[model samples]
Target: MASQNILDVVVVGYGPVGQTLSILLGQRGYQVAVYDRWPSLYPLPRAVFHDHEIRRVFHAMGIGQDVESISQPSATYQWFNADWKTLVEIDWSSESISDGPVGYLFNQPSLEALLDRKAKSLPCVAVHQGWEAIELHERADHCELKLERVTMQDGKVTRSGETQTVKAKYVIGADGANSFVRKSCGMAFEDLGFQEDWLVIDLKPHEGVKLDVPDIGQWCNPERPTTMVPGGPGYRRWEFMRLPHETREDMQRPEKVWELLSPWVDPEQATLVRYALYTFRSLIADNWRKGRVLIAGDAAHQMPPFMGQGMCSGLRDAWNLAWRFDLVLRDVAPPALLDGYTPERRPQVRAVIDASIAMGQVVCTSDPLKAAERDAAYLAGDVPPLPPFPGLTDGLIVRTQNSADGGIAGQLSVHGQVQNHGRTMRYDEAVPTGFQVIGLDVDPQACLSDAALAALDQLGAYTIGVTHDASKVVANRVLYDVSGKYQQFFAQHDAKIVIVRPDYYVFGAARSAAEANDLVGMLIAEIGLDQASAASKSHASAVA
Candidate 1:
């Protein structure tokens, strides 16, 4: 009887990742219930940075206006040695293909609050705070989750707990590092061989006052490795590595914290908002999915803070999984489509972890001799190159001659300033959901075959043609690329048409109408749409 009311999806955890997933599911008209132990959002600073790709996700969720209000563009991230000499610098201020600042710094609490408000406005989304998912039972058609209602006395002190059960077609674990869902699934982690404890402090000065500190930089001094970064609008953050002899309790003391901040500001002048010790670890889950149960965010992987991608990566996972789940639940495609999620996302997460660990190695040095050597190498103009942004290497991406190498396939689709009808906005804002067929000064509809067109229509894909001149309108949803980025991208890839997935990844591309049809056919087959169509045909024949 309980199984009769099974939801479309059950999400365990109400953090940013889980909340984002809930809203996405709600937007798709899926019944989603989110469970978390805490009664409210964590009102402290956690993640402080996100890149353009994440900003794109925010826009998809209809909260772009809110994000612009609370976020500030991040500057170059510089690294310096003992003598304050510059080593390697990553230019985060450059424009990303997503049509915004490469990176932005913002308060995590504010972002989460905005997400919570948006989630509440949706009818299909229900957040059950003070409830925790404690146990799991997998059935043939649905997953069962046992949830506990937690009662707290003094804001956080747990007083009592009551348990209940809910069934869902699928279960997603977006909980933090210490996830009960991951443990319930008996999943293990593959340690990437990196761990360190560091004391993190957040401070805010009196109104109309500003603390004097570098915007963002790493101090690679052998005596003490430290990091200073802008913590949103009126806040600042500093992280100090805990030496071998230091304990977590000692480093968290107010006096010890003051000693670390003495160089920048007087402890008496500024208010210490939050201070805590964190152990940064590098790990990736051995398996992201087991049967109908899947894990995302920290439950799937964890990385050091060097790249500021810890939370951003989790958000990406949510975005990637949301569309796949939506497609399966709607029966638009077969359940096998979900198989691509782990393969497509794990490699991307691994790339982020590896890059973060490499950056950590550069800043976690404790030897005087090695520090001197590093500084000397930098002084001699021998700085190492920063790693390029990671892209998808496998699963649901094209790797053929019709949509040849160096094409847009498997990469994130680029955004440009576009004018649609009389309105001007980013390209993505014009086409927010589903697969899109974009053509450069060409009509994609005319290029696709009847079968391909039928499949795309079934998927609810948007067909738009981008042209440089507004006078030459050749398609219904033609947008004028005012910034010229779109034209540049098409020319560089030698493609007239490109297929973009719902999550804004390039599915494939082609230089001509026939090739465009082939590209669309390839995506249809790869995503199991062809199988669904075949099954429908066989069922009709059997009925006859």
Candidate 2:
């Protein structure tokens, strides 16, 4: 065997995405190095969206369970008039998305700290906080990252100098909207720049207003439209609409900011913390994986915050790649196995962007005629619930062996209760551990010949072959199912080998053992693993 690479992954930037990636890689025993321009996690809170999947990622990192107590549950989603009259209401508590908690009410700082701590806890992860990736170049086999050293003073730059280069086999860019890595990779950000500017202010109400309202509440009118969200830990967020020709001075008038909130809460009780102007756009990269480097999160796609999936989409990308990297890094899968990451993610990435734009059009409607029409239509007493977000394709994608059903059909069934006393194994329940799931509608012994069973016992994959109701099979892999209904995969993507990546996204499926063997062989080939190891009796004996 030739010498293997010393480092497996080099992650750029130390934001949530970067930190999460580092910790995941480290946990998998990969030598991971991280570079970031900033040394400290700012108490600054910038984003607002956190869906159920994001919470699951946090839980996977051992950090999510605390989000709800700090951030109140948004129970009733609504649109209100500037005069404070309700226009439209949707039940946010509908438990619409999944059994997993959806729509976080917390801010960025808290979440980042949680992730930052997790990254530092990993034994194989090294974080270089104050270093920035100043330059980058990829050779035929290796990619090089040049980190520049810098010194800063009271809110200003003091000194900038020498660059240190680090080489890695795989690189991930979670930098930011203005990602240097993305820019250097020659990936273009197609910003559909918004026609209006939005002024967002973070405030801590002196006397907090405790109300169960929305995942987000939109105050819509032609003149001014604002959004209010619960920013956990006594923090409240406000996004005020900015019209053309309006100056920051006009928006800063304490009276103007208060008018938007005074309807729901007292003016004297709230104090503004931070305020900034924003223009929304939905953008996607033409290509996600370019050469040796790949991009995720804001670095790859930028969606308006209207739909609250901005961060969730990115975290899902990290989830999908992290486990696959484990396979490739450990030489378990073929290197080209990484090829599927981009194609699998790009469709959903683009879908979220489109979802945001479509939803934004409805939530932020400003046309006088249209606004009146919306109000009149609501008064007419016939408005369907918020149009289902097509961005959620988790349930729709079915990959199973049951070809007619579009899901993998299982042949594993035993007429009599045949017990494998020697095996002494059953699916572990209670604690949630994410794994690649193989659901058996019946008994496993009936599904395979000795050879196939022997092969599975060899790979040692974290695959739970559960023999029970199809519903019970999906219950353990609950984190990945957006709707907590994984059994639907039977009808969505027809196949028996339902390959689910860590992030809950299906990689692809195989309907038969031959297909599974082919997919497994392809994976093994990529990681430089013994090709026959995935399907051979010899591989099985080694594990045994």
Top-lDDT structure, candidate number: 1
- The best candidate by TM-score is 1
The sequence of per-residue lDDT tens digits that candidate 1 reaches over residues 1-544 is: 1445889999999899999999999999999999988888988898999999999899889998799789899999999998888887888898889887799999889899999999989999888998877789999999999887786545564635667789999999999898988889998999999999999998887777666676899998879999999888778899999998888899989999999999897776788889889999999998788989999999999999999999999998899899899879988788888888888889889998999998898899999999888788878988768657777767788866322245467788888788766677777666657788888886677676566677777676777788897786542456788888888888888888988888888888888766887787788888888634532331110000
Each candidate structure's count of clashing pairs:
0, 31
All predictions: root-mean-square deviation over Cα? 4.0, 6.5
Question: Candidate 2: TM-score?
Answer: 0.79
Expressed as tens digits, the lDDT of each residue in 121-168 for candidate 2 is 888998987777877889877788878776645445444676678889
Deviation in angstroms for 34 in model 1?
Answer: 0.2
Stretch of 10 with least lDDT, candidate 1:
535-544
